[model samples]
Target: MRRAFFYGWVIVATLFVVNFATHATGNMNLGLFVIPMSDEIGISRGLFGWLTTSRTLAAGLASIVIGRLVDRFGARILIPASALITGLGVIAIGSATNVVQLFVLFAVIGFGGLSPQGGGLLTSVPVAKWFVRKRGTAMAVTSMGLALGATTFVPVTQFLIGAVGWRRAWFYLGIISMTMIVPTALTFLRRQPEDMGLRPDGDADSRLGSGAAQRSEAADEAVWTLGTALSTRAFWMLTAALALGGFAAGGGVHRIPYWIDSGFDHDLVSLSISVHAASAATVMLAVGILLDRVPARFVAAGPFAGFSIAIVIMLSADSNTDMFASAVIWGMSAGTGIVSQPYLWASYFGRSFLGTIRGVTMPTILVATSLGAPAMGYVFDFRGSYDLAWQVVVAIYAAAFLIMVSVSPPRLGRPLAD
Candidate 1:
């Protein structure tokens, strides 16, 4: 008989903790410290922005090597070590006295907090290894920690900054990071279910039969490697769609100023953001379920289309109601990419070599993501309004939609020797 409980759920729970803690420490809660830290340390707001950029760039650079490590040795060694590195880095930031120090510390956080072993591509790869048919549901559940972390930890960080001061606040966050992340990951994480005589989705061996079970344990479930995956047309198409969608999404990300500048009350704008976050969370699970049911290309196309529509609504919007409606759609659209991209990577390429494939694709996606908001900001600087930017963003989304829908899954094959 199948065990009453599968350790795969335990893996999910471990990753959930890792995601929650690393996200809070990595980027989400850093905004809470910007004003206080900047004022006290004598840095401009613009200079402070570079800290995030540094973190993102460092993570992108580290992904290639980390991805290979996760694929080889598994998350067991890397995740805890990443947590330890991130925790210490956060703690060290408490002592930073200059921009150089801050930049170095943020880069440390990037390497530790945002790598495949820690936050961004962290849970997806490990979860993909443990579950196939249930991969969507698994990713959805684990990713919920990100939203929850933002909700819970941002306020906590703000409170700590207020009560203990900014320096002490970093100390506390680091402590929490090390305490929560390292132990859970070390205790529960494993390479794959088969490592422990379990199968993906916790299916009994008898159900798979001998051949399917062997495939599940070996190359059948994971056939493509970095070289073969890179050789496919589908991989390039997906990367292009991801880049376009990221850039398009960035155009709308700074829409708060558009509403505020147009005379919407700050309270209304804040409420709209909440609406967006709620909608995004709901859509994540919805997208996950759809991934299990529909063709991934179709599932992936929905977000690009939804985002385009939301932007079109906002560009012509004249009132609070229109903005709120746009927020709902915008949030829903934002949710699909995070969950689906990783799922499609695994589903199309197979779980075995997912880390390496994701690693290679991550830098491109990260560059697109990092550039999106600033590019929109740049347009607004010259034009004085978001009209031109949003129009361009809508066009970008259209291209992404077409590219996404046209993508075909890659055929399974052995990877060539390096």
Candidate 2:
């Protein structure tokens, strides 16, 4: 049974690695390809920005549906299937001939690639389902995949883009994403601990009993229907905070190159972006450890503070050193923000309905990101700088900080009924 529990951890770890790869591949590739794709296709940066928007929009819309599917069917089917489709979409992007083709292809990729699987949603839900006492730690550890992917894959993709050109990089990434992520998911991921004749948190012999008995016991756990979650003040607060946070973060992602355009060497700019990934990954791991020992709300707040300060520094900085420092701060904060929210949902609501709730939450947050991306790009196109956008982001982060502080953890022992 202990070995079985260990296997569960292994499954989480595998998903973590895959999440890291997919995120790194998805995000970093865009920045690397921006110039080449734009030059080849004769589209403005603002127009090209829609590719990302499409991806986010598709992802946002699909997350809820995918969550419902995962709940009804299981991760064993949903995860691997999404991966395969995502890989095909990546290949499609590589093969795209025109802007329309790219747009349609990436919309498919977004559907396949963008849904909240791989690490945060995918691993967190299943892992949370398996372990209650250790849920925070598990989420933190698994979410580190995002950071790890950013850390490792950014530099690697940077090298690939430089060496093989962006098109080949997409092809290689597509194949690798499919081959690696799909098999690992198929072999390891299980929907619930009960499938293995165990109970959540290894309590097979405890008050919950085993198998059917544990399932019966778990039936009483808080199950918030969609209406109840929507009606709660806490839910709106969380949604607002996360949505603003996404706007700030997404705006920055869209505008990073523009920031670099302000007198820094392009390679140095890429290095700075890579630094953000590395910092995010490191901070995520540290925060994950800390989350295991501290109040999650406090852990969540730390990132907002760091992010706000980083924006201030970025606005003030004129040199590479300042930019690098800003990247570290922002990266760390962003990493924390990404990991903290899912845990927040689990703690505030209930894990049983997490996928569905996250599905609803995801669209709002992603739409903010999608709109922010192109809007920031347009700001740069018109104003020739990202100063105004950054100012707005700073304000948004401040609001997020306040909102996060206002969030009270839900009462843990009772089921919240609609």
Candidate 3:
């Protein structure tokens, strides 16, 4: 009975929809636009890559500001505004006539992609506040929407571009943003369970005296302030992992061009991304449930491992089958990144200040991500192949994997007397 009616689940459902729409038209989808834009505008691929870096820098900067706003104001105002702004930004991209215009517009998208309430810490932090015992499950379920969005949107957008053109395809994204996202945020999103007069995990107040309630409340108190959290060993360790996530997963991840260069047609390449997203969506739910039962470090190591192996596979692929296989493997690692990274924070430091913690850590994630696409693009321009760039990615993943496995529970900022 308790499983069916929790309002915390309402936040989960709402965020799932939010993430779905946000990511469907987000950075990941930028892959679909690259060839079309280059074909029409005839810009250097190396120059085209700067757009990803610019957007990453903008989003990183905005995350710091948005993090504070989220902690202070809650999702009530932030989420809706992000929807409108992000949707308009996407629409504007269709009208861009020059590289400067595209850069400016993508910056707008970077802001809206994960703002005070759109994605990342914004969504995860609130859900974290609303579910102590079920934090992993909640974040996992919410993020799965991105996988579903990517799964459907990539193929659909590909088809849209084929039928109508890339400009019309982007207009559809703007329409989707307004029609689907705004209502969901306004209808179901809340700052906390207390706003609706309920306890976290949605237990009845009548049970306040019960042992279960006491334990849940006690667990919630075991959290770190931003200052306290910063001083911990685990903070640096985990943040490092998240940073590498940008380079390994973030940099130059637009595999469409790489595949297109390898001889696959656009439609086949698009299907590979769909398979990747399908696998990612599958892993998010599975890993969420897995983290609830197993140690997070155990599950975390696998992402780096999968990523490294996938890069190796990409280097050897001579057929569409190999491309889909490697893409699917890459998707598995991405699932851990989007889903497990937050779970790691709440598990280690608790969620009381996740917004600020992730806010402070956001730039580290972005700066590395900012370098990734351009690095790959330049490498391709230099060598006419992604083999070397992908090999370099594998090496980084290897180091990150070792770092992840070496992690132990962080020593507290103020340890008890020996």
In terms of TM-score, which candidate is strongest? 3
lDDT of 2 by residue, 1-418 (tens): 3444444576568768667667544675467677777887786767777778888888887887876766555577777888888888887777778999988877887787334422245556666666566676677677777776766666677787789877887888888778878888888788766666556666553333344544443463576667678878888887888788777766655545666567777777777888887787777766766766777777786777887798888778889998899889878887787677677777667666777777778888788878777777788788878889888888888888889888886554356432
Assess the local accuracy of residue 250 in candidate 2 as a C-alpha lDDT between 0 and 100: 68
lDDT for each candidate structure: 0.75, 0.72, 0.77
TM-scores of the models, in the given order?
0.84, 0.91, 0.92
lDDT ranking from best candidate downward? 3, 1, 2
Clashes (candidate 1): 0
Residues 65-161, candidate 1, lDDT per residue (tens digit)? 8788877778887888888888889899999999999989978877773432222666678889888888998888777666556556656775687
Off by over 4 Å in 2: 1-5, 113-120, 205-221, 411-418
Model 1 clash pairs?
none
After TM-score superposition, the amount by which residue 88's alpha carbon in candidate 2 deviates from its true location, in angstroms, is 1.4
Global lDDT for candidate 1?
A: 0.75
**Candidate 3's error at 32, in angstroms?**
1.2
Clashes of 2: 1
